[model samples]
Target: MSSKSLQARYEAAFMPNYGVPPTVLVSGEGCVVRDADGESYLDLIGGIAVTSLGHGHRGLTAAIAEQAGSIAHTSNLFVNEPEIELAEELLSLLGGDARVFLSNSGTEANECALKMAIKFGKQHGRTYFVAAENGFHGRSMGALSLTGKAAIREPFGPFAADVRFVPFGDAEALRAAVGPECAAVFLEPTQGEGGVVPAPEGYFKAVREICTDAGALLVLDEIQSAIGRSGAWFAHQLEDIRPDILTLAKGLGGGLPIGACVGFGSAATIFAKGDHGSTFGGNPVSAAAALCVLKTIASDGLLGHARTLGEQWAAELAAVGHPLLLGVRGRGLWIGLVLDGAHAGAVQEAAKAAGFLVNAVQPDVVRLAPPLIITAEQARSFTAALPGILDSASPQE
Candidate 1:
């Protein structure tokens, strides 16, 4: 079917949670995707940062196929080799003696982490949660309750009580909010949906100290910053501060669906048998795909590549010196191009017309999360075209 007809069909049949994009992508190779009209585009957002190795990665496909052929799934009732292997590999990369609880998405990982924190809190007679203002967690009840965006959370309330939000990047506010009554303090290493804002220097160190002093668990939501998206295995690793609980997803499974909540030290044993379980949490196929993603990243040195290219890409874009380009936020392939005016939606459309897929995450912030496998040539092509794209968009004065 043609792109227009497919979109019409989609609107007619599916829910309106996500408005339809102009293109109906049919296939992809590496960082490029072809729409139903056979037009190709460089996917700069990389399926919202989930397609780590990009489309049609041979190693990932092979791992999925091999695992599916042998053992595609195993219920939590039985053991699975791929699951075990992936867990061990993840813990090793995390540099912790941690236990992993596998799930299917970032929200699920966060949910699992919440459960651990609540359980741990109950044992200590604490019942409060401390999160950051403008932080986005997940849509699920518990996760949403912890999310500080009031517009989204207000409609969903009466949410779970005892959750407080402090201004993000404000160490004093965070210190005041977290204390003996708090069960856990959840914060993202970098705020992805909140316009790709990074934590200020030594902010995490202060948070760690506060959580430690308060005897509350520190849950780092690394969903968007983990799995080599930030040039580190986990973004928190760069700070050298260990969170009691860490949630990961997005690039974790390359393109397949998988997420995990890793618990360290005492938090590792917080969940007892049957405390929380999933029917297909750690299916062999997804586990295999994750394993392959890790292997390819290590062997290809994609982490260093992402870091170097991200720096170069940011510098090139800045050097373009476009009037509409205000500044850049974030690190690695995860970037937010801050525009001088409220024209991000128009810029996104213009970029799409110019054979590029970027996300206007906020009114003036364009998010770019290209695949880890993206070449310098591919990135440069977008950077070279960015000025024209902005001109076409016509930002307000």
Candidate 2:
């Protein structure tokens, strides 16, 4: 069917929440996808960084298929092998004495972490929360309350949590905001939705120290920066600091859906017999998929690959020296190409026309969270075409 026809059908059937999509993607393989019109484009954003193994990867598909063929769902009432294995693997990567709560999405993982913090803090007479400005936890009500962005968060107001917001990347501001009454401090090691911004050097370490001093929990949301995206197993580990709680999703299950909330130290035992649970929290299919992703990332050495590509791409993009370009920030595969003006939209459209998919995360910033398996030739193609794309998107003086 034509993209226009499918779009018309979509408008008639679905809610207007996401607005109109530019194209109707039919299929994908490796780092490329095809629209309904049968045209191909390099899939750079990797399904908002969800497709860690790229599209239709053999290992991921086989694992999902193998598990689905044998068994899929097993409610929390029963135990499953993959579920146990996946949790064990996550804890292993964390290198801590921790417990994990599995769920379906990043938001759910954050919700679980919030509940853990709340329960633990209430016992100690601490009920307040501290978060970073421009930080985005999730869209659900509880997670939304901790999110500092006003535009997407304010509309769904009257939230229950008493959260305080401070300027992101400022350790002193965070220290001033956090107090003994604070249950926990929620922050992202890298703020993905806030334009692929990385935490300032030593910022996480300072926060860890502050949280420890105030006897509060430190929760780091690594949903968008984990699973080899940050050139490390976990972004916060770059600073050699361990948080009380860590939430992960996005790339954890490759292309399948899975989320994890890992609690360490006192936070691990916060949940009682039945504080919270999920019907599909640890489906065998998703757990198996996650196992495959973790194994493949390590077996293939994608962590070092991502680290090298990130450095090379950042340096190359900066060297392009285009007039419309401002600078670059972020770590590993997650890079934000800053623009000289609020022209990221125009640039994104121009890039689409040139057979590359990208995200205009902000008016003046283009975010790139390509798959860890992205090849060198595929990356250079975009860098080679970026000058022309910028020229096409640049305004006439």
Candidate 3:
């Protein structure tokens, strides 16, 4: 079918949650995608950082095919070999004896973590959860309650209570807000949706101390910043801090839908028998895919590759010296370009026109999370196209 016709059908049949579609992407290979009309575009956004190995990675494809051919799914009642291996690999990467609760997406992971927090709190007489301002957890009622954006929360009236918001990057604010009544302190190591902002130095340590003092769990939402996206197995590792509960999803399955809520030490034992479960959680196919992604990343040295490429990519962006470009922030392949004004939307459109995909978090912030396997040539192509794209987005006087 024609792209326009497919889009029309989508509008007529689907919900309006995501608004009008962008382009009807038909196929992809590596970091490039082809539209229905056969136009190719570099996917810098990488499905908002979920497509870690980019589209149609051979190892991941083969793993999925092999697993599906053998045993696709057996539900959570029966323990699966792939699930066991994936959990073991994840725990090993995190450098801890963590028990994992696998799910289908980031929201489900957060939901499970939140429930575990509540259970942990109830056992110890705590009830509140303190999250950072401009922090985003998920859209579920429990996760939404912890999210800091009031505009989104206000519309969903009478949400789960006992959740408070503190300023991001402010150690003092976190220390002041956390108390004995708090069940957990949640944070995103690097705020992906919040303009790719990183916490100030000593913030994670201070937050960890405060949570320890208050007897609350430290939950780090690493859905966007984990799995070598930030040049580390987890972004929190960059700061030498550890979280009691860690939520991961985005890149874990290498494009397959999978998420894990892992708990360390006492936090790991909060969920008793029948406390929570998911029918499709830890399905063999997704687990096999995740194991393959982890194995590939480790064996191919993609973590170090991401770090090298990210530093060079940031340097190139800095050298561009576009008047509208404010600066670059973030680590690894996850980087954000702050614009001088609210022209990010225009800049993104221009980038798309130039055969590259980017995202505007706010009007003045554009986020780039290319595949971890992106070569230097692809990075240069993006850098070369960026100046022209920025020029086209010049502000009107």
Candidate 4:
């Protein structure tokens, strides 16, 4: 169907939650997508960082097909080989002996983490959770309670109680907020949905210490920063600290949906057999797909590739020398362009016109989370087109 016809059908049938569709994408390959109008775009957003291996990745496709043909799902009542293997692989990647609870998305992973935190807190007589301002965990009641955005939370009144908000990147403020009453200190290693902000130096360490002092669980929400997006396998690895609970999603299954709540040490033992469960959480097909993603990332050395490309892309963007370009922030494949003015929306529109895809995370921040498999040539193509995009969108002097 044509883009307009599909859009009309969508408007008539679908819920109005996401507003109008941006474009009706017909197909994709690697880091490029073709819209219904047959215009090909360099997809830098990678479906909001979910397509880790990019579109139509052969390994992922084969893995999913093979697993589905063999056994798609058996529910939580029966143990599945693929799910067990995927869990072991994820724990191995984190460099620790940890326990993993599978889920379907970032929100569900966080919900599980929050429940685990509450259980841990009950064991120690604490009930409060400390999160950072502008931080986004998820939209579920438990995760939403920890999310610090008022606009998103205001509409959903009476969330899970006892969540305290502290300023992001302010170690002192976090120290002041985390006390004996706090159950967990929740934070994103690098804030993705909140304009790609990274916590300041020593901030996470301070949070760890504070949580330790208060006997609260230190939970790191790496849903957007994990799976080699941030050079390291996990963003927190760069800081040399281990979180009590780590939540992951996005790139874990390449394009398929999967999330994991991994717990370390005592946090690992908090969830008893009957404490929590999900029927489709560990579906064999999704778990098999995730295993392929992990193996492909390791065998292809995508971690080093992401780090090198990130530095190269950031340098190229900085060299554009546009007055509106303020600075660049974030690590590895996860990056954000800080605009001198609130021209992110304009720039994004211009970029689309130039056959590139990007996201304006905030009024002044443009986020880029290209696939781990993106080539240097593709990066250069986007970088080369960016100057003209910026020039076209520049405010009239």
Candidate 5:
């Protein structure tokens, strides 16, 4: 069928909350995906940073297939080898004494962490939360309460009371907001959806101190920035600080769906069993996929590759000095290109026309989170073509 026909069928069968997808993706390999119409485009967004190793990775597929043929589900009633092994691998990667609660998506991970935070507060007679404005958590009730975006969060309203919002990257605001009544302070080391904003210098370190003093749990949402997406094992590692509770997902399973909520120090013992559970959170197949992703990322040295190539792409784009360009920020393969005006949608459409895929994360911000395995030659192709793409969008006088 054609793209139009597929789109019609999709709209008829599914809700329009996500809007009609622009392309009907048929198959993908490496960094390129073919639409139903047979046109191929470079997948620079990596499915919004979920496809860590890129499309159709041999090892990733093999791991999933092998695990599937053996066994796929065992529920929480029974333990599975791949699930246990995945937990061990994750704890090792995080490099600390922690307890892991597996889940099916980033929001579920945040939900687990949120419950832990609230429970910790209950123990000490506290009942409040702090999160960054414009930050994107998950969409579930508990996780949505921690998200900072008003447009997406407010309508769900009258959320859990005492939830406080602070300016993104402002240590002072965070410090002022977190107090004795605060149960936890939720933050993202790098704000992936808030135009790929990074924490200011000394911010994470200061927040750590403030949370410690206030006796509040520090919850770092690394859903989008973890697993080498930001050129580091964890974004918090780049800041040299550790959170009491850490939420991870997105790239953990490459393309498969899996998430984890990990607790450290006193936070590790917050849950007292029977408090929560997930039916298919870390099933054998997904666990195996996640294990493969972590192993491949470590052995392939994709962290350094993401950092080096990302820096080079930033420099190249900056050198062009296009009329719509403002600046670029972010680390590793996760980048946000800020435009002069609200022209990101225009640029995204133009790039799609030119056989490239990018995300208009915000009105004026274009976020690029290509697969970590994307080569320099492939990346420079987009960078080289960017000037023309920008010109086609909004040309200067």
Candidate 6:
């Protein structure tokens, strides 16, 4: 079908939340996607950082197929094999003796963490929560309450009371905000949705100590940074600090939907019988896909690939010396091209027109989170094409 026809169908059937982009994607291979119009584009955003292994990964498909054929879903009532196995693998990767609560998406995982924190805090007569400003958690009620973006939260106000926002990357501000009255400190090691910003040096370690001293749980929202996206299993690992609660999703299941709220130490023992539940949270098919994603990332040595390739791409893009470019930030496959001008949206549209996919995460920040399987050559192609893309998007002065 034509892109216009498919768009018309989509408009007729779906809500107008996401205004339809020009192209309607049909299929994908590796890091490239083909639109309905038979044009291929390097999908650098990778389904907004969800497709870790890129499109049509055989191992992911096979795992999903095998698990679905065997047992697609068995509610939270009965334990399933894939869920158990995936939990074990995730705990092992985290390098901690942690318990996992499976859910359906990043927001759900964060919601689980929030509930856990609230329950845990209530025990100690605490109720307030601390989160970083500009931090993006999910759109769910509880998660949105924890999110620090005012514009996103204001529209859906009457959010949970007693939630506080501290400036991100400011250790002193975080220290001041987290106190005995604080239930938990929810933060992202790197602010992914806030323009791919990583925490300053020693920031997380400082926050960890602050939360510890305040008797508050430190919850790291790694939905966009975990599962090898940041060239590491988790972004906080770079600092070697362990969080009381860690929320994950996005690339965890590659393209499948799966989320996990992992609790460690005392936090793991907080939730008891009748505490919380999700019917199709850890369905076998999604669990199987998640397991395959983790295994494939390790076996294929994608972590090292992400680190090296990401560093090279950033350096190369910086070397381009574009007049409108500021610099680059982020680690591994997750990157942000900082623009000197407010032309990120125009640049994103221009890149799309030139057969590339990127995200204008902020007014002046372009987020690039390609698949972990993306080749160095493919990355270079995008970087090489970026200068012209920017030039085309610049104001015709």
The parts of candidate 3 lying over 4 Å away from their true place are none
Task: Give the range where candidate 1 is weakest over 10 consecutive residues by summed lDDT.
Answer: 153-162
The parts of candidate 4 lying over 4 Å away from their true place are none
TM-score quality measure for candidate 3: 0.98
Give per-model TM-scores.
0.98, 0.99, 0.98, 0.98, 0.98, 0.99
Task: Flag the better candidate by lDDT, 1 or 4.
Answer: 1
User: What pairs collide in candidate 2?
Assistant: none
Error of 2 at 330 (Å): 1.2
lDDT of 1 at 242: 98
The alpha-carbon lDDT assigned to residue 270 of candidate 3 equals 89
How well does candidate 4 match the true structure in TM-score terms? 0.98
What tens-digit string does per-residue lDDT give for candidate 2 at 216-274? 99999989988999999899888799999999999998878899999998788889998
What are the lDDT figures for the candidates, one per model? 0.92, 0.92, 0.91, 0.91, 0.92, 0.92
Candidate 5, number of clashes: 0
Clashing pairs in 3: none
Better of 4 and 6 by TM-score: 6
Tens digits of lDDT, candidate 4, 169-273: 988888888888888899998889999998889778888888888788999999999999998889899898999999999999898989999999989989998
lDDT, residue 48, model 1: 85
Error (Å) of candidate 2 at residue 234 is 0.6
Candidate 5 on 1-397: residue-level lDDT in tens?
9999999999999998999988899999999999999999999999889999999999999999999999989999999999999999988878877889999999999999999988888999999999999998988888888889999999998787468999988888888898899999999988988999998899999999999999999999999999999899899999999999999999999999999999997788889879999999878999999999999998999989888888998788778778789898888898899999999999999999999999999999999999999999998899999999999999556
- Please estimate how well model 1 matches the true structure, expressed as its whole-model Cα lDDT: 0.92
